[model samples]
Target: MSDHPHPPSFDENILKKVEALQEKYAAMGQDLNAYLDGLLHADYLTYWDYINLDTLLSLQHPITPFPDESIFIIYHQITELYFKLALHELDQLNTSASKDPDLILKRVSRVNRYFEALTHSFEIMVDGMDQDQFLKFRMSLLPASGFQSAQYRMIEIRSTSFDRLLREEVREKYEDHAPGDLEELYSHIYWKAGAVELATGKKTLTLRQFEVKYDRTLLELAENTFEVNLRSLWNGLPVAAQTDDLRQALRWLDTNVNINWPLSHYKSAVRYLQRDPEDIAATGGTNWQKYLPPRFQRRIFYPELWSEQELANWGKGWVEKEVFGVK
Candidate 1:
C-alpha cells in the first residue's frame, strides 16, 4: 500500500527495441503496426522446420531396389550438397567488394577444405560399394554419368577462366582467340574431347544431353565468372594480402581439385570398370583412361602460382605410385 509508482515487469530494452523498429519501419514507408501484429502471431523457429530436414530426407529416390543403391544416391546427394555449400562461399566472393584480406582468405580456405574433404572421402566410391553390385546396377543408369554434374563444372568455371581448363595442346589456340568468343571456346573444352566416341568420332549421348540442358547456363556462368573468378579475385586483392599462406591455400586447392580428386576418381573407375586390354567405357562413353588422368588433362586452375618443376610434373609421381602402386 505504501508503494511509490510500481515499475513495469517487461524488459525496458525490449520496449526500446520495439520503438526503434517502429521508427525504422515508418521511415521506410512500411506499416510497422501490421508487422508488429504479425509478429505477435508468429511461432518460434524450430530446427527441423528451419532446415527443411524432412524434405531433404525425402529426396533419396532410388530407381533400383538394390539395397546399396540408396547408398550411391545418398553419397552423391551429400557431395552435391557440399558442392552447393562451396558455391555459396564462391558466390559471396564473387559479389563482395569489401577488400578484406582476412575475409578472402577465409572463403578460399573454406573452399579448399571442401575440396579436400571431397578428395579424401572419395574412398566412399572406391571401396564403399560392392564392385559386382555397382557394375550390375550401372546398366540401369545409362546416359546418366557423374560426368554430367553441372555443379562440378560450375566450380571449375568459378575457380578460373575457361582456357585454364582446356587440354594443354589447344590452350594456346583458345587463349589467343577473341576473349568474347565463348561459343567457340566452349566447343573446345577438354570434356568435348573426352566424350568423343573413339571409332565413330561422334559426341556421346551423355555429353550431348548435358549440352542441351546446360550449355546456355554454362555460357552465362562463364561470362559472369570470367572476371569474378577466384584467380581474378585473388589478383585483385591488395599486394600485402597476397601472403604465402594465401598462395599455399590457392596451390593446395588447385592440386586437390585437379589432381588428387581426379586421381581418386580414376582409381575408382579402374577398380570397378577396367578390364586390362581395354577399360570399360564409362556410362558417359568417355575414353576415361585418356580423359581422367591429370597428366593428360593438366587442368591447372592457378598456373601462375606453381613453379616450373611443379608444372612439369603435375600429378605424375606420388599419384602414380599411390594409386597404381607403380615403382
Candidate 2:
C-alpha cells in the first residue's frame, strides 16, 4: 500500500455524488416554478418536509398538569406570538415609513389591529381565570414582568410622547438632526396652519363642520406626506426638511399613546386582586390599589400640534351644550 492511506470510502463516494448532483441540478433551467407549485399543494404528511408545521406546533409546553394551567400558558404564549409579529410589523413599517411616510398610517392601522386583539385577549384571559386559579401559577412568574420585554419597550418608545433621552438615542443611531429638527417640523405645522387660515378666509365656520373638514384634509395630507418620508427613511436616504423626520417621529409617539388602553387592564387587575391577595403577594407582591391611580386620563402625544386655548374653548362650548341639552 502507498504511504498515504486511501481516504474513507464512504466520504469520498458521498462527496463525488454531491458534486455530480450539483452539476446536474445546475444544468437544469433556473426556474423553480414547477417545483414550488408541487410543494404548495402537497398533503399534510408531506407538508412537514416543506414547512415543518409539526415542529412548530410541538413548541407549546404546559408547566403544570392542572387543566387550567394549559389554558393559562397557551393564552400568554399566543399573546407573546402576536407581540412578536407586531414588533416585526412595526420595524418593517418604520423602515417603510422612513422612505414613504404616507404608508405610516396604514402601517399604524395594522399595528392598532394587533393592539385591539391584545386588549381583547386580555379580557378573555381575565374572564377565564378566577382570582384563586390565576394565583396558583402567578407566583411561578417572578421577575418575568411584561415590562421587561425589549420589543414592548421599542413599541412604547416609538409610540409614546417623546422622552428626551430616547429621542437622543434614536437621533444618534439614525443620523437625525436634533434641535434644528424640531424647528423644521414645527415650520411644516405652521405652514399648514397658515394654509388653513387662508383657506377659511378667517371666516368662522361652525366648529362641527370645521373639525370634520379640517380633520379630513389634515389626515389626507399626513397620509400622502408620510409615504414620501417613509420611503426616504427606509433606504437611509436624506430629505430636505428635518421637520419631515420630526413629524414621522411624532406619529409613532401618537400611535403609542393611543394603543395603551390601560384603564381596562387596571380594572381587571383590581377585580383579580380582590379575589387573590395571597397569590399577588406570592407572585411578586403587587399592590393593585397603588397601581390604579386616583384619576385616569389619556396622555397627549403631540401637544404642540394643537392650540390648547382653542381646544379648551371648543370643549367648553361642547360641554355646555351637552350639559344643558341646548343642542
Candidate 3:
C-alpha cells in the first residue's frame, strides 16, 4: 500500500459530456419554442400582451405611512385574489356536480385545500402585523369588511342551504314578502311524493314532515354528490391505489361545516377588537368567541357521509353536541 491514499482523478471527459448534453438540451428547447410559435398564431400572443401586470400591482393602496401597512395591504389583496380564484374553481365544480358529481367532489375538495391555505395565511398575517400597526389601518376600514365580500357570499350561497334561510330571515325582519317560493316548491314535491306513497298504502306525511323529509333528501343528495366524486377517484385502481382522498374530502367538508368560516370570522372580529375595543360596543358586534353558537359548532353539511364510528373517532361525540362547548 502507498504511504498516502491517492486522490480520485477528476473526469474531464465526463464534464465535457455533461456540458455537451446541456447545449443539446438548450438547442432542443429553442426548436420546440419555434414549433410552438408556429402552432399558436398571433392572436394568442396579442391576448398575452393585453395582460397588464403593472396596472394590477398598482391596486395596493396604503392608507397609513406605516411600514407594516404595505405588508398588510399586499397580504390581504393576495388573499382576496386567492379567494377569487377559488370561487372561480368552485363555480366550475358546482356546475360539474350537476352533471358529473364525482368530478365536482374532487374539485370541491381542491377548493377546500385553498380555504385551508387561506386560513393559515390569515394566521401568518396576524403574526406579521403587530397590534399597534394593525390598529392604525383598522379604523380606516369602517363599514367595508370581509362580510361584504361578494365572492365569499356567492360561495356560501352556492354551497349551503344556510344562505337561503338567512336571506329569508333578513327579508322577514324587514317586513318584506317572504320568499317562500322555494319552500313551496319543496312542499309541492313532498306532497306529490306523499300522495304516491299513500296510494301505495305507505304512510302519509304532513307539510312539516315533508319539510324534514326534504331536508334529509337534500342532505342525502349532497352525500351522493360527494360519493360520486370519491368513486371516480377510486376508479381505475387496485386496493392500494384507493387512498384516503374520500376521507380527506370528508374531513375538509366537516372542517368547513364545523369551524372554517366561523373561525375566520372570529379571527377578523378579534383582530378588530384588539385594535379598537370601543368599536365593538358601538358597532353592536360581540367578540368572535360569542359568534360561534352551539348549533353552528355541531353543524355537519353531510352527516350521512360519516358513519357512527367515524364520528366517535373524530371526537365530535355524535351530531347532537352543541357548538360553543361540549355537551
For model 3, which pairs clash? 102-228, 102-229, 294-323
Q: Which rank order by TM-score, best down to worst?
A: 1, 3, 2
| Local accuracy by lDDT, each model | 0.81, 0.46, 0.49
Error of 1 at 6 (Å): 7.2
For this target, which candidate reaches the highest TM-score against the unseen true structure?
1
- Per residue, candidate 1 scores C-alpha lDDT tens digits across 25-48 of 999999998998898999999999
- Per-residue C-alpha lDDT of model 3 across residues 32-122, encoded as one tens digit per residue: 4554466678555454357777687789888767777788678767777877876676556433334443554566777787777776666
TM-scores, each model vs. reference = 0.90, 0.50, 0.51
Candidate 2 residue lDDT tens string, 240-298? 34346456554443433332334445445655655544545542544334323212122
**Model 3 global lDDT (CA atoms, 0 to 1):** 0.49
Q: Which ten residues in a row have the lowest lDDT in candidate 3?
A: 190-199
Quick one: best lDDT, which candidate?
Answer: 1
